[model samples]
Target: MRILIVSWEYPPVVVGGLGRHVHHLATELAAQGHDIVMLTRRPTGTDAVSHPTTDTRVDGVRIIATAEDPPEFEFGRDMMAWTLAMGHSFVRTGLRVLAGERNTPEQQPWVPDVVHAHDWLVAHPAIALAEFFDVPLVSTIHATEAGRHSGWVSGPTNRQVHSVEWWLATESDSLITCSASMRDEVTRLFGPDLPDVSVIHNGIDIRTWPFAPRPVRSGPPELLFAGRLEYEKGVQDLLAALPRIRRTHPGTTLTVAGTGTQQEWLVEQTRRHRVTKAVRFLGAVDHQGLVGLMHRCAAIVLPSRYEPFGIVALEAAATGAPLVVSTAGGLGEAVTDTTTGLTFDPGDVAGIATAVRAALGDSAAAATRAARARDRLTEEFSWSEVAERTAGVYLAAKRRVRHPVGRPSIPERPLPERDPGQSD
Candidate 1:
């Protein structure tokens, strides 16, 4: 099967779990002998003369990375404008790629059997390409706007983003989500008339994670929290719990890995909670550093107020790291309360402290749970297993009969005259 995968981020441009999900899915599909063409933006800017629309292969997948045409847009600062401008760039380069304008035999035009879009960022391009080519539009809503804001889409910018997400949900023929909770969220937000949403949980490669024996040895009880430091992540709750956690377990410390808009606020929170001396903010630790921390840490706790799916928990579990996660959205589905790992309520400061203390204090129980989590990954979250289920979705999408429709036109002017640096 010939498949075209569209996403905003990929390797070297990973903003979060979405990039890793797309990369693994594309590579795994290609490994299964399917012709996979991934359309993503170049990490480094490119122009016609300098480095235009690179076509390269990695792990049997053909990656066609296009550049920002106007080259004046920045994702963080000009989010809404950047999205509209990005839609134009995607459509322009996508048409050329489909038309095989290069004329070279190797770079000749190729028709994809189905178009799979990752999220709202690439929705315009995905819809345009699918409509123009008369192919099925399969979309995966990794997370929703309302979900991030805890079902509050009150502000103008938030509403604008929500409308785009609804447009993508309505335009696509088939839909996919990372978890059952996300599927339910989409249905609740979109309507009673949307198509069936397939629930395909995120995958992890155990070989890369490489499980280790995590017996709680004698050392500082270091609890690791790895993810974006956003409001929805509930890192503040973790900080609030730190002081209480220290009452029971003396010499306990926390190592925070990652950075976001809430970094300063979270730092202030640490000072307010008087855990400034105990908590170490190691902002934006790389994957290598993160894994090392996970192996050595007594336990990893994820106290999320709104988590569609906890991919970081899976990564930690694969490394035999004991998990103490909040029962928020799909996080509850990711870890069983007593079987695989300990669970707590979202934003519950006392719950967070209790769960962390449990994992830290009990060496035998923590090791047992961590081992169970590592074992669970092989059965349910392997990359090959995830790819096969994803392939099934593509096959079903290909079988759908699409009606001829006009492509969505990109506006000449950007979304707003002024730049609003707001995005999820």
Candidate 2:
């Protein structure tokens, strides 16, 4: 299969989980003997005029980055402009590739069998290219604007984003989401007329995150919270729980990783709670650093108020870090309370503190759960499985495009329920 992927983010320029997901999915598809072409935004400072399109190969996948610098403006007006520019650039570069102007002797020009897009940022280009080439469009809605804002669409920028999301859903032949909760959210927004939405959970490559063996902690144990330090991320809830956590487990330290708009506010809150000395804000840590932190920490906490699917939970579990996550959105589905790890109600500071204390106090049981979670990750959430399932969606979309009449409807199959004994 020849697949063309249009996304706003890719490696070395990743702002969030979408880039990492696209990188691994494309690479894995290429490894499975399929041709993959990725069109994403160029990194900052790259001369757009001189290098309108930059091509590179990573792990057998060809990446074509088009120059589309974000505009400076308040609200999401800049994003609106960026999306338009990105779409225009994608269409321009895609035309060149289709004409063999950008291909080498070994790799001849070929029309993509399917055009897969990630999120609304690249929806315009994906829809345009699919129509131009008469190919099936497969869209993956990683998250939605309404979901991010708790179903409150505010301002022109947000309304525009929401409109684009709706357009993408209606235009695409098939849709993919990271969780069942997200699948329902998309259905509610787009209605029953929308294309079949498949639930494929985000996966992690366990081998890439090499686990470090840490000896039993004789001193104060460490609790790590990684992700954007935003209100939606529920980092503030974690901060609020620190005082209660320390009362039971004195001298326990907390390490907050990742940077976001709420960093300053979170710092202030720590001072107000008088737990400033016990918390360390590492801002953003590199991949290896994060894996190391996961290994060293006694438990990894994810207190998200609205997580579509907590990829961090999978990463922490893969590294054998005991998990404590909020029962918010798809997080509860990700971690089986008391089995894989523990879960608490979102924003319940006392519940979070209790889960953290239980996890830290019973090191043996926590370690057992962590080990089970890692095994489950390999069995259920491996990239190979995800790629296979995604490829299935592509094939289904193509079949539907080829035979529109008397075509069987794409089934609403949620990902297999989380199982401890599932095999890879």
**Cα deviation of 402 in candidate 2 (Å)?**
14
How far does residue 42 in candidate 1 sit from its true spot (Å)?
1.2
Cα lDDT tens digits, model 1, 173-238, are 889998898999998888665666899999999888878786436766888999998888888999
Q: Write the per-residue lDDT of candidate 2 for residues 1-424, one digit (tens) a residue.
A: 9999998889967988899999999999999999999888776445467556678888998898887543443223366875686688788878886644844568766689999999998889898889888889999998887777667565567677778888888889999999999999999876676788999999899887776554589999999999987767888889889999999899999999899877888888889899999999999899989988998999999999889999999999888899999988889888999999999999899999999999988998999898888888888898889999999999999524432322212223333342222111
For every model shown, the clashing-pair count is 0, 0
- Clash count, candidate 2: 0
Return the clash pairs for model 1, or none: none
Deviation (Å) of 131 in candidate 1: 0.4
Model 1, stretches more than 4 Å misplaced? 44-50, 102-108, 398-424
Model 2 Cα displacement at 315 (Å)? Answer: 1.0
What does the lDDT come to for candidate 2?
0.84
